[model samples]
Target: MSLQVRIMTPDRIFLNEEAEEIILPTNTGQMGVLKNHAPLITALDIGVMLIRSKNEWTPLALMGGFALVKQNQVTVLVNEAESAETIDPNEVENSFTIAKTKLEQAEGQKQKVEANFVFKRERARYQVIKQAKKM
Candidate 1:
């Protein structure tokens, strides 16, 4: 098994433990890190990190982050990570609608920022929805 694994966000560190493997949503795509994985670090996209341990796949919603795998330890410093099961479908859907409308009306830098925020939130929400379908 891998020695240690951590998934951290600015607000909290959701998980930390020894795991058999971790599947991350890299900027490029999804990839798995096993024990003694080749030393490498990469950026994470807004997607799911499927942590494999305890004979189960734990879905971690990562908005963005960087991952480091070394010496059988994997650490993911993410901007966000939320359990898909805990998310309320209505919340995600409502947020998406608000974000889409703001994005559609964006006209200036400040407006654009709002739009971007919405986009990110909606994307994360959609990811949760998609991952929920898998479970």
Candidate 2:
């Protein structure tokens, strides 16, 4: 059996994937979902969600949001989402570096915001890059 996943953002719908299993990036940590798992609605961490289909795994980066799971269907509504094909290693690395620098020099609320964004983006980079290597 499989499940339904719809990943959306303010700009557009990033994905509507169907798979045998899903690995979510929860704020607490990673959580795995399979058919008939308990119903849940939980926060999504800034990381990656791996989709398993036909014995193949597809990985995509995700930002904070919420996921609603009931029965065997999971709707992933995220703040931001990106596929491996869409991520640029150089760009992600630069963003991570800039965020780190801002954190070090952070002195105000604005700096804190920048630092948070950096952390979120860097987490995506790490997840996607690791998936790329495995594939």
Score candidate 2 by TM-score against the native. Answer: 0.86
With a 3 Å backbone cut-off (N, CA, C), the pairs that clash in candidate 1 are: none
> Residue 107 in model 2: shift from native, Å?
3.1
Per-residue alpha-carbon lDDT of candidate 1 for residues 1-135, written as tens digits (9 for 90 to 100): 455998888988778888787788787888988887888989988776777777777676788889988888888898877887778877888877888888988998998986886687577766767766776
Q: What is the lDDT of residue 47 in candidate 2?
A: 86
Model 1: residues >4 Å from true position, as ranges? 108-114
lDDT of 2: 0.84
Question: What lDDT tens digits, residue by residue, belong to model 2 across residues 1-135?
Answer: 679878889899888868899999898999999989899999988888898988989888887899999978898888788887888877877777777777778889987887877777786876687787797
- Cα lDDT for residue 44, candidate 2: 89
